[model samples]
Target: MIVAPGACRRLKPPYPYGSISISFGETLFNIRTDNFILGLTFLAPLAILFLNILLVFKVRRILFERKMNSSKKQRKSHISLTLTTLAIMIQHLASGAKTVIGIVRPELVPYALIIRHRLIDLGMISVPWIFYISHPMFHEKTARVSSFT
Candidate 1:
């Protein structure tokens, strides 16, 4: 028989787990659909992206410092360094794109619905990263203005 979504234990038929133990929606220890663990799994990529963003910030700081005191040739080198950091940041964002597709295309794979829910949960978990993504944009504008000064 096909089961409905979010069916309670009442409808669950017995399954063999040593003996007949029919586990259903949202159990203790939660071998079935542990949202917390699922959420952490989803945040794994965001955490990596956050680390990448941190590395980008570190690179940006170094470039900014060098731009302040370096010769023209040295300043040109900082541009290449900045470009590399930007490339890494773009790669991180591309990973996020994969996550977004998983969220958006839940119909393509029903099992992925849980993962998609977890990804949506990441919005709460990724609050810190929101600022991380913004910082570089703001820094780039500031760096440009300072260069002209």
Candidate 2:
């Protein structure tokens, strides 16, 4: 449907829809109704973000209560895991970026996708490393049950 400031004409049903590929060189007047699904993409992230805030607060509260009773290693590991979970949840928001890819600067679609990919990839790839670095368990050497030398 081509829409002006105050008017819009619904495209007839021979081929009534547009796609992101077709929308690339076109202007905003070249409208489509498929944006609803795109809007749905952000819902998961929004819910996760809300849950993440709650989880962070709960973990902090628990850590505060157990501060003196828990060993330093236990406290450190708990904090490390909570922070990692929060970071990963934040990274999930980038998955929604594709919904707005060509809407605001159509020319930068490629760059936007690249940046989004990098952000998501960096977050996913760093998770194990973050755990390894933050938790001392990964750094510990296991006692040999059988001599391998």
Q: What TM-score, over all chains together, does every model reach?
A: 0.37, 0.62
- Per-residue CA lDDT of model 1 for 6-84, tens digit only, reads 5333322232334332434544444554456546545766787787677767767877878768775555545555455
Predicted candidate 2 versus true structure: per-residue lDDT over 36-146, tens digit per residue: 656666566677777888888888998999999998888878888787876687466776565466666666666666677788888888777787788868766688798
Clashing pairs in 1: none
* lDDT scores in order: 0.52, 0.69
Query: Candidate 2 clashing pairs?
Result: none
Off by over 4 Å in 2: 1-36, 97-108, 141-149
Model 2 lDDT, residue 52, Cα: 82
Candidate 1 RMSD to the real structure:
14.9
**Clashes in predicted model 2:** 0
